[model samples]
Target: MTYYLGIDGGGTKTYALLTDDCGNVLGKGVGGNGNHQIDHALAAQSIRKAAEGALNEAGLRIHEISHTFFGLAGADREADYRILHPLVQDIGFTRNYSIDCDTMIGLRAGTNRPYGVALICGTGTNAAGRNPAGQHVQVGGFNYMYGDFGGGGSLNIEVFRSVIRSWDGREQTTLLTPLLLNFLGYDSVRDMFDDFQDHGKHVPVHAAKLLFEAAAEDDAVALEILNRQGVELGKSASAVIHKLGMEEDRFDVVLAGSLLTRGDRGWIRNMVEQTVAAVAPNAAIVTLATEPVVGALWSAMDADGHAVSQDVYDKMRVFRNFEHIKHQQDKRL
Candidate 1:
């Protein structure tokens, strides 16, 4: 029984799935932060731990696996490749593995087609485009230094800045002022700003939801922040589409990440949909409908030259999440 391994390594957690030739999951495992950009040692340990746990559960040795594909965050540049190449190779698969940006996994997971654009609107913004000829191009996700913006994290800080701007008389008072103060239980903007100053500059990523709440109440400031963010995300996607010469191509602009999947339909998400439609007239926007790691599995199968069938995807859908997958081990067991 040939086995395949798929791993999605991200900053928050690492998840790995082991499957048989038919895409029937054998076992799944998870571990800690796996973004090598944060800590190479931690990422390496996380990947190994997750992969080993899955292998142990499936009672299979690394040698028994036919192929492995790792979709990893923080794999944006050549330096990242240098770090990840040796890191994954240390897993001892005899080189039967493939490495690509984690966004590619989102791309594959959200769309049935092999080629299209993947837009990530999470803690940070990033995008990747795949053309029919198998060419790949990535833009943004390099942080502010690289002109990246329009993710949940970006929204979080921008909200605070908006509050500061209102206080400085640069902008009119916004619902965000009261909404944020109430949400965090701060007595006033001055107190909140002082606390942020003394504690740390970083705002909690969850605070980004406040923007949507304020926008829902018809707050102009909140709406502006959201519009700018949506435009930024759309701009990133548009850049990728044009670079790949897929502007006129009919394809799915797969949307993944916390913000787009759950945020306001009339704002950020709608803006992305509109942007894709204007640039790529035939491009349709769709939220990721499967566990992202399933894309990792599909990528592995594709990289190994195996045909990916509807049945294969159907079998993998059983992988909803790490917890869900663990609860439903193979019935044959």
Candidate 2:
């Protein structure tokens, strides 16, 4: 009756899943943002809340869990680990746990093989890959100032800058100008620019949806932005493949994150697929066939020396798809 915990702590939300040694899910809970880079207090709060909720739903106490795996955002450096490791430990609920970047879980979500690549592009972008020889390499995840781009935040900033340029007559007129103005409740682009500059007003993350909507309408500017982002994501994956010496080796490249998983827009995914195929013709692109948290569960089982069967993996996949459908339906309501 050993229970394990798996957590996927991301920029926008955190998810926790409780499972038995046989991979049967006992309970699932979700909570607020857990990106340590944004706010440490909030991240810790989210991690605790989600984990507690899952434990309660499973009718179990935290001390009963045998092992826990946390895949968290902003855990790229040793400093980050220093901040997160103790925070998770302070929960005082689990006997053993491990923490790593969220990308690791995304990688595990795609393949059971020991070697492959993962690219995440949601609130931020990052790339990680492992070679068959156990060597690992990573790219991006340095934040915007460090030349990182091609995530929701980057896309929003670019669209905002484009609106400012359009207002200043520095760039061609774009549908984004009016769309953003309306979305922001501004009567004029000048007022919006003034508010942004003088008042520090920021565009919402959901503004990314507008960009994709415009692109779907064949807006040249919006399409170009998405195209560039897709290429950038592809190049990041390509860099990881080259570093891992998997250029000719067939491997799985898992694609996850809000922007890449957007149901209506296949252009971004297509661009990435085309770009990667040009370099690594044999690489298989996996579109998050299961939730990343499931990977955490698999890792947890592996750590505890439990046998994981293909039947269990299939069951996890089915459970994830059901959860996804339920989430979408709830959103509509």
Candidate 3:
């Protein structure tokens, strides 16, 4: 039986899925950082290792694979392809290969139909939509500096601003400032200032965790930040919806990203629900808790023009359920 391979290459982790021609996933593997900015050679090595590991776990050799699909960060540009293609080709699978950005795969993953929208909020943010006619439109994927609002980095930056304002006695004290200091591993606000000067790293992506923590404690600043975040994300989603002329179309708005998948997705979900309900009342809201590698695999099948049969969807759903169970058990343990 011919097997297909699918990979989801992200900033923090690379996931690989091995599946048969019929799209039943056999086994999976994971690897180190695959963000294009973080050492392409090492990232590619990690990807290749993960792919090989998945093949081994599946009890299949690379020679038996018919197609491979890689959905990755920074794969949108020719330069990125220049850096990544050689490394992927080095794997020597060679029957057929396709590559695209993570959002493209995400849009394809949710349904067999051609029209839908996807909003990704992770270490960064992006939005994309595909109409039934195969026409597409995207908004706000410029890069971290110009865009990427409603993401970890954005949340962290807001926390930092709140902390600084509290230090200056300019704003009402909240639970966030204390938590921010703890997160920075500093004894005082002055220490945070000094650390930022020394490290020169402007924003702290990890500090976004404090937003959820503060929200849990009912901090006003945290709530406001999260609300604004929701509004911003809503605006982005609205832009994509308008671009598709899908205001009246019944389609699914698939929330695909680390931010949306996690338990902390509450605030964003609230925003999405409120905004979309008012504007695109007919649109369905769904969260893709499945790892994007599964989405990438579904995308590969779609790209190959393979009919997504009930058997394939059922098998994938089973794997997703198994994964969810394992995740819950791990959390309990």
**TM-score, predicted candidate 3 vs. hidden true structure:** 0.87
Worst 10 residues of 1 by lDDT: 323-332
Q: Write the per-residue lDDT of candidate 2 for residues 175-286, one digit (tens) a residue.
A: 9888888888999987887888898777787677777878878888888888888888888999988888888988899898878766427667888899899889999988
Q: Give the alpha-carbon lDDT of every model.
A: 0.83, 0.83, 0.76
Top TM-score model: 2
Tell me the spans in candidate 2 whose CA falls farther than 4 Å from its real position: 321-333
User: How big is the positional error of residue 72 in model 2, measured in Å on the Cα after superposition?
Assistant: 0.6
TM-score per prediction, in order, is 0.88, 0.92, 0.87
Candidate 1 accuracy as TM-score: 0.88
Tell me the tens digit of each residue's lDDT in model 3 across 36-148: 76668768877887788789889987777777889886676678778777778887756577887777777666655677888877766778888777787877754657665
Candidate 1, position 312, lDDT: 89
Return the TM-score for candidate 2, rounded to 2 decimals.
0.92
Residue-level error in angstroms, candidate 2, position 292 = 1.5
